[model samples]
Target: MKTYFALIFSLFIAATAFAQNDTTQKIVEGRKNSPDQEKKPYVILISADGFRYDYAEKYKATHLLALSSSGVSASSMIPSYPSVTFPNHYTLVTGLYPSHTGLVNNSFFDRNLKESYSMGNKTKVADPKWYGGTPLWVLAEQQHLLAASFYWVASEAPIKDTRPTYYYIYNDKISIHNRIEAVVAWLKLPAESRPHFITFYLPQVDHAGHLYGPDAPETEKQVHFVDSAVYELTKAVTTTGLNVNYVFVSDHGMTKIDREHTISKPAAIDTSKFIVSGDDILVQLYAKDRKDIQETYQQLKKEAVDYKVYLKENMPTNLHYGTSDDWHNRIGDILLIPNWPKVFNMYGRKQLNPGTHGFDPYAVMDMHATFYAWGPAFKSHLKIPEFQNVNIYPLITAILGLNYTEKIDGTKQLAQEVLK
Candidate 1:
């Protein structure tokens, strides 16, 4: 009887131990399959510069259309006021307007730095002081995710004192095929070294749009070329067997401009009294003295009949400009915005491009850009109405599951309808 009881107790202990080990193994597997422990999702943001919203409809871009059919698309992506390149690109990444980003235009004078920042000025372009708000890549790195960029605006700059995990300085000479291959190679990196967020920029579309009118055959050819490149990139990424969420966007669209509609500076206004910035569509006049402010405003108001002039404090509320002191210092004492197809000149002008942007976003359909997203995270066959470009930053962060606490103007609500 004693031997029987001892044997039974030993058997009970063995059974309990086996059950506990089985439960432990199940818990480990559960954690391994948890949403947080699974392979992290990847996001690839591609920008085909000057890719107007209508291009997908007008051109033979079967790839883009197919992607749109499979994912979410917007009728148009409304650009921030000034509807230019650098400002809108930075806005898309930082979720801040040009006024807040301190990149009011493609080229602006930094009063504090006492230096001019132009697209052509490589040194100044790489300087971090010129950029404001936290860039997407910098935010990603802070959360232990890696980021990479290829020829993105302000990507070369060490924004917020940190650069992307991998980046390339702007190099127009690099062929599109080479750029695509480089991106593929980056994607093929070891899982430990791979980047979670990647940015690719293609400027050929914008260049073609500037050299020729938006509807010209040359522009159409370039658009097709861009489409083909994008298709190749998608194919390459798919071959890697990695799940990637792709987002295609453009900074702004191009509008036809004519040489016949030129508005030169009025002779009454002294050129030396103020410094002016901006191109034909928008002119920013900075008075040298406080007294010249009213004079410049009155002169521009009286002489420039084709353009609308406004004092800095009285800028249009819809523009979301002139509120920040940093932007105010960069802007002019008097703002001049021309009517459609009209050009304003501060100096003797040369031949202008057949197409250009920087028009008021609300007034011109041509100023609207493109937005399309495709991936597991997005709903298929979803079409959303046009929303501000500022909202893209929040949508991207949300998709990456990043914790963002900045006071950004963007909201995920603008893009929530497209998410699964």
Candidate 2:
């Protein structure tokens, strides 16, 4: 009985240790970089979620400023409309607009599947059928190039029936030192087995922004943390004696919201008639019956005071959203977009976060994200004008010499401008 109790205690301790620092690497075996792929240069595609275009300047992120100044920097990279996390992160990898990729918002309902997807729902996030477009990792793996992801939006899913050759399920359990060490280890592998394309993500800045407003010193501290972390990762990579390119981007920017006077559900729309999805910045109404869309839209428009209401059909074409652009039909029928700074609190049941995103990136400049690239694959001391985020797909593919035939929205113009 004492031995059995000891075994139980040991199991509990083992589980606790695993929970603290989950360094489990998921690998797809029986994959190798071809001779041609092995010759290709390396790319460490990094996304700093919610790192705005100006944060490095505003916060004096020394490492990032110096690193990007040496290579290529964008004035601002325009996130696709409803500039939010899940959608834009997925957009960065797939090079498709949220409408085209079917990840319309961080949380949205799919009328056809009679299901919904949310960033918090691990099951929905991991299911491959919900994703659309050929992600860059998939594009690389399909062409016999090995790829890896430290953490990415859909990297956990078997999208296109192919996961990255090496990846980690999204988690914050690992320390920055461990993450940097992992990247260095991946690079140090034999040429044929090493990943030519790697992805890394940092959520520190975004988390700080959301918790403490963008202008807070607390947020600035996180900015510096990311700055130091990236510098460390790159510094570690230098030890491997391999040329590893890096493109640092963000899913979207952050903005302080008016949390005091949050918008409430309009009395004009009956909850029984429509299913609600979305949050403070964007509110989407999915009609229970097809007949409810028009009436609900008209009523919401009449009642909307601080927000704009539009039928999915009438949404601005520039957003690349609406009836015509709804490739997967995941977009809401009646959409409500709160004007800048105003956010919905639904029934006023809960207080709101001081900072938020998911606004129109063009209309609200605060929603624009960052883009910085460096290493042997890119031009030096070059700064480009603001470009749409979709163009990033072609840029990385161009760097890694990965050919993609899919007619994605991103063009090769940025690649031609930035690469050697």
Residue ranges of candidate 2 with Cα displaced over 4 Å: 1-22
Against the true structure, whose TM-score is highest? 2
Error of 1 at 392 (Å): 0.6
Q: Model 2's lDDT to the true fold? A: 0.91
lDDT per residue for candidate 2 within 1-420, as digits (tens), equals 999999999997886566435669999999999998889999998999999999999999999999999999999999998799988988998899999999999999999999999988766788998899999999999999999999999998999899999999888888889988998999999998999899999999999999899999999999999999999998999999998899999989999999888888889767799899998888898899989787777777778899999988999999999999999999988888999998988867676779989999889999999999999988999999999999999999888888888879989899999999
lDDT of each: 0.81, 0.91
Model 2 compared with the native: what TM-score?
A: 0.95
Scored by lDDT, model 1 comes in at 0.81
Q: What digit string (tens of lDDT, one per residue) describes model 1 on residues 330-349?
A: 77667888888887765776
Instruction: State the displacement of the C-alpha of residue 165, model 1, in Å, after optimal TM-score superposition.
Output: 0.9
Worst 10 residues of 1 by lDDT: 23-32
Q: Which candidate is the best by lDDT?
A: 2
